[model samples]
Every structure is written in structure tokens, then in C-alpha cells.
Target: MAEQVQVFGFWESPFSRRVELALKLKGVEYQYFEEDLPHNKSDLLLKYNPIHKKVPVLLHHGKPIAESLVILEYIDDVWKENYPILPHHPHQRALARFWAKFIDDKVVVAVVKAAGSRGEDREKAIKEAREALETLEKEIEKSNKLFGGDDIGFVDIVGTVIAGWIPAIEECFGFQLLTTDNFPNLIKWSDQVVNHSIVNQILPPKTEIVAFMKANWKF
Candidate 1:
């Protein structure tokens, strides 16, 4: 029997998009419910993810899996042979986890700080974010096409989903992180990831995202 899958998510959320992409890539059929978030979170979302009260909750055969990363792991495990999201090797899996955690702990926080604060605080945050981006650039400098070292994998799913906001982050803070010459590897990787069919199908217009971001900021 095919396991029934349902995902509660919001459109503009990168984490939510991550789950959608993973499902599509694996050819898994799922019911998608878009949530309003913060203002009006659904009871199901609360029931599934009581701690965070977040979206991107995947219900597989009525079993709830909260957190996008955790759901990705679950998807990969359930459909490993068909379209493997994670690398089979433990070391490779660790690298993907490291990058994902860096994005969560460091990049997102820096983005929030850079957008809301001013003077030395914002500048310091940008510098810290640059350091994290530089590490990514270095890793991809002389590597294969994807973050997984080849075709799209766990790292590619995580990296691309989050990096969609790089342009918005730069414009929001009046800073330019990606340039023609500087951060070439990251720029190349970003282009490839953004242009992928999986991402292109799911993302909204860039202008809409920009407008949405500008309005959503605390400043």
C-alpha cells in the first residue's frame, strides 16, 4: 500500500519549499496545505510541531515529521533507492549536515541582524556572514557541479533553498555579496542551483519576493 503524505507549508518560506522540492524529486505524491503563519497557524501545525509551532510539517501515513531537514532525512530514508537525497557515506552526510547547520545557526541570524540593526552592528553581521559564504566558496572552488559533489543531493537541496534569499538579503541591507569577480565559485554554484527545474517550478517571481521581503522586515 502507498503511504499517504501531506505537507503543511507556506509559499514564501524557503524551508517549506525544501520539503516540496524533496517530494517532487522523489516523485512522492503529497497533499500540500499552505499556512498563513505567525498570525494564523493551523491546529494541525500546532499538533504536529508543538515546540516550534512551525510549518513544513510532513505527515507520512499520518505520522508527523517536523523540521524541514528532519523531513528530508525521512524522505530520503523512505525512498532511498529511487532518488537518494543523502549520500550513502557517513562522512559525506556529516559535511551536508555541517553546511545546513551553519546556514541555520549563523547565516539566518546574521541576516536578521544585518537587516534590523545599523552602524557597527550591521557591519559586523555582514562580515560574519561573508566568512560563512567564503567557506562555501572555498569548498566549491575546485569541485564537482553540485554541493553533493555531483548530481543534486541533500546539500544541494539545503543550500539552494536557503540561498534564494541572498539577493534579497544583499538588497535589503544595501550590500553586494555576489559579484562577477568576487566569490566566483559561490556565484556559479548559486546560478546552477537557481536555474534547476526543481527550483524554477516552485519559486515565486523574484520581484514579488523582493517586495515581500522589504515589507516583512522589522525596520
Candidate 2:
């Protein structure tokens, strides 16, 4: 029997987009359910991901996978034929996973949490986010066009938020976190990543993202 795949996710979520990109790159056909999030979550979503009660729950032949990064690895492992998400070498694969975790835990999380803060707390969040970005900036400077060299890989997928959501975060918070002067390599990399054929095809419209942020964020 053919595999049954379904994704429960939110449209604005970077996590959801990561799974979507992985599926698209591997040419996997699946059903997509957009969750209401923080208000209403479907029974299926809740059943599959009770621990987090979050979107980006991937159902594969009835087995459930929660967490976007874990789902990405699963997709890559299952498909294994085309558009490999992680590097083939063992050492390189380890490094890819490391950077993916770093971006999620350090950069994306910090910047986003800070974007919603106020006063001195906000300042400290921004400071920590900048420190994380600086670390990533040096990493990107070592590659050409992407963290994985010529093509998108695990780290690249994890770093997608820097391209797609950071702009909206900056707009809503009324400050720029990524700039040509402070992060030239990352800026160039963001441009390339957002414009990559697979990514550009699926990326949500920037204006809509900006409007959504303004509506949802207190800033």
C-alpha cells in the first residue's frame, strides 16, 4: 500500500514551513491541514502531538511525528532517494544537525521571544539574539550561497526563518535585527535562500506576513 501522509500546521509558522519544504524538495505528496492554533486545535493534531499540542504534526502511514526538525530527518530518511536534507558523510551529518539545533534554540527562538518583549528585558533578548546571529554570520561566511554550499540542507532548512520571518519580526518590532552592515554574509545568504526555486515557490508573501505580525504582535 502507498504511504498516507498528512501535515497539521499553521500557515505563519516557521516550523510548519520546514516540514513543507522538506516534503516539497523530496517530491512527497501529502495532505495539509492548517491549524487554528492557540485557540482551536483539531482532534487529530491534539491526538498526534499531545505533548506540545502544536501544529507541524506529521502523520506517516498513521504513525505520528512531532517537532519540525525531527520530522525533517524522518522525511529525509524515508525518502532517501532525492533532495537529501542532511549531508551523506557521518561527520557532516552530525554538524548539520548541530547547526539546525543551534538556529532553533539560539537564533530563531531568542529573536522571536525578544520581539514580543518590552523595556530592559527586550534589550537583553535583542543582545542575546545578536550574539547568536553573529555566530551564525561567521558560519555562513564559510559557505557559498548556503550553509551547505551550493544547495539547501538540514541547516539551511532550519535557517529558513532568517529569510522568511525575520523581516516581518523586524517590521512588527520596529527595529532591524539583520542588516547589511552587521550581517552582510547572512543578508546575502537570506536573499539567496528566499530566492531559491524550491523556497521561493512556497514562501508566503512578505506583505501578508508583515500584516499578520502587526495584527498579532503588541509592538
Candidate 3:
């Protein structure tokens, strides 16, 4: 019965890991199929997500769901009897979604753009990434714990990309962008997220991720 859920994912993808973590937190069992991105994509992945042509696709029973964020929401809604990803309070849930959108529009895309560009384009990308991170830092200074303010919650699960991946970027780039002194709250929040027992199961080893970023991306 539990095997009805299937996950198509890529290694080292923050989005994929987010969905995986959500499933783990909710105690849902699913078959995982790894996909090669921008290269060799699986036939089922092509069939499941003909539009996006991307991984992190979730198949429940026989219905297919694409996009990691969408997949997370689906997982939580499907398994809502146990763990709830979005808050019961509408305002809190909106805040959570807002920050997740912020990360996507600001940090994730900007970092990749910077990593792939050069000269002035790279400089602009870097600046955009830094500003986005500063926003994250300020949020942490206020929240004092997970994004939910107490126990680990939805936004924290989605935002794990920031907690688990950002410092690795600093190390791989040999830069001091996310410094502890400047972002004390963010640093503390990262430590808290990584230390969560469930998060450890979904996040990749820091060393391996750093190496991958160094080889695949510029910074």
C-alpha cells in the first residue's frame, strides 16, 4: 500500500531533498527513482512531467505531481492526518510561503545565474545573491528558532536549502559572504536545522555537496 508513492529525483537537488524530508517527517514510504538532469532523463520522468522536463516528480497511486514545492504541498496534504506542512493558521501559512518564494526568486536563481556568468553579469548576480541572503539573516534574527518560531515546521523544511547548502557555497567559492559575525541568527538557525534528526536523513553530506558545487558551478 505504501509503495504506491513514487519519487523521481536528482542527487544534490535541494528541491528533491525538501520533498524527501517532508515524506520522511510524515512517515510516508515511497520508491525513489534517480534522474540525470540536463542530460539523460528517464522515460517515466519524461512521461510524468512532459511540460517541465525535470525531476522531483511525485507519483501517488498513479497520479503524477511535478515541481518540488508543489510536491511538498501535495505530500503534506495527502498525509495531513499526521504532519502538517502548512500552518493551520492562514496568516502563518502565507508567511511561510512568502519566504519560500523569496528564496526561490532571490537566492536560488540569483546564485545559479552568478555561478554561470562572468565579469559584470557575475558581479550583478553576486550582489543580488548577497542582498537576498541579508534578508534571510534578518528573518533569523527575529524568528529565534525555526521559521515557525518553535518546533521545525513547513517553511523550515522548504528553506532547508538555505540552511544545508549556503555555507557550502562559501567554502566552495573561498569567500566570506555568509559570515557568522554578520549573520549570527542565520548561522545559529543553520546549525539548528542541520542538527534536526529528520533533516540529517534527507540532506547530503556537506563535503560531497561542496565538491560538486566547486566542479559544476563557479561559486
Candidate 4:
């Protein structure tokens, strides 16, 4: 029997987009289900991911995989023959995993805090976000185009927020987290990643994302 693959995601979620990018990078065909999010969530999503009840869930052959990072690794593992997402070497793979975790735990958190807060708290968040971005900027400076070297890989997929979502958030909220002056390398990488043929197809339009952010205003 052929494999049954499906993705449950939110349209504006970078986390959800991560799974789709990985799948497309591997040339995998799967069904995509968009969740209502924030207000109305699907029962299947809750059933599939009872713990967190969040999106970017991967349903493979009737089994469910929750969490975006875990789903990414799972996709790479199942489609090993296709374009590799994570590196083949154990050390390189470990580094990719480390960077992906850092993007989520530090960069995403700090950027969101910076965009959503105000006054002194916002100042502190902006500092933290800048620090995290600077570290990533230095890391990307070593690469030719993307964190994955020539092609988009694990780290690149995880860093979609930096390329697509962050700019929209920055524009809509009138906050500046990533700038060309402060992070030239990252800015270039962002342009490259967002313009990549496959990635560009999956990313939501910046205007739509801005409108969504304005409507939600939940940061």
C-alpha cells in the first residue's frame, strides 16, 4: 500500500510552514489541512496532539506526529532516499538539530516577545532578540547562501520565521528586530531562503500575513 501522509497546520504559522517546506524539499506528496486556530481548533488536531493541541502535526499512515521539529525529523527519516533534510553525518546532524532548537527556543521566543511587549519589557526583549539574531547572523555568514550550504535543509526549514514571518511582523507591528544594518548576512540569507522556488510557493503573502497580524493583534 502507498504511504498515507497528511499535515495539519495553520496558514500563518511559521511552525506549520516548516513541515510543508521539509515535505516539499523531499518531493513528497501529502494532504494539507488548515486549522482555524486561536478560536476554533479541529477535533482531529486535539485527538492527534492531545498534549499541546497545537498545529504542524504530521499524520503518516494513520499514525500522528506532533511538534514541528519532530515532524521535520520524521519526514526526513521516512523519505531518506529523497533530498536529505538533516545531514547524513552524525556530527553534522547533531549540529543541525542544535541550531533548529536554538531558532525555536531563543530566536522565536525573543522575537515574539520583542514584537508583542511594550516599554521596558519590550526593550529587554529587543535586546535579547538582537543577541539571538546576531549569533545566527554570524553562523549564517559562514555559509554560502543558506544554513544548509547550497540547498535548504533542516536549519533552513526551521528558520522560515526569520525569512517570511518576521518581516511581516516587523512591518505590521512597527518594531524592528532584523535590519540590514545590524544583520546583513541574515538579511541576504532571508532573501535567498524566501525566494527559493519551493519555499516561496509555500509561504503566505506578506500582505495577507500583515492583515492577519493586525486583525489578531495577539503577537
Top-lDDT structure, candidate number: 4
In order, the Cα lDDT scores of the candidates are 0.80, 0.88, 0.82, 0.91
How would you encode candidate 2's per-residue C-alpha lDDT over 37-138 as one tens digit per residue?
Answer: 657888988899999889799999999999999999999999999788899999999999999999999998789779888889888999999999999999
RMSD of each: 1.7, 1.5, 1.8, 1.3
- Writing each residue's lDDT as its tens digit, candidate 1 over 1-219 gives 235999999988888988998888888888889898647999888998899999889998899999988999999999887688888889888888888777777777777677778899988988887787777778777584778776778877877644587787677668766775878888788788888887778766667777877777657
TM-score of 1: 0.93
Ranking by TM-score: 4, 2, 1, 3
- The parts of candidate 1 lying over 4 Å away from their true place are 1-3
lDDT of 2: 0.88
lDDT of 4 by residue, 80-106 (tens): 999998999999999999999999999
TM-score of each: 0.93, 0.95, 0.92, 0.96
What is the lDDT ranking, best to worst? Answer: 4, 2, 3, 1
Q: Single out the weakest 10-residue window by summed lDDT for candidate 1.
A: 160-169
Clash pairs of candidate 3?
Answer: none
Clashes of each: 0, 0, 0, 0
Clashing pairs for predicted structure model 2, backbone only: none
Over all chains combined, what TM-score does candidate 3 have?
0.92
Candidate that beats the other on TM-score, 3 or 4, i.e. the better one: 4
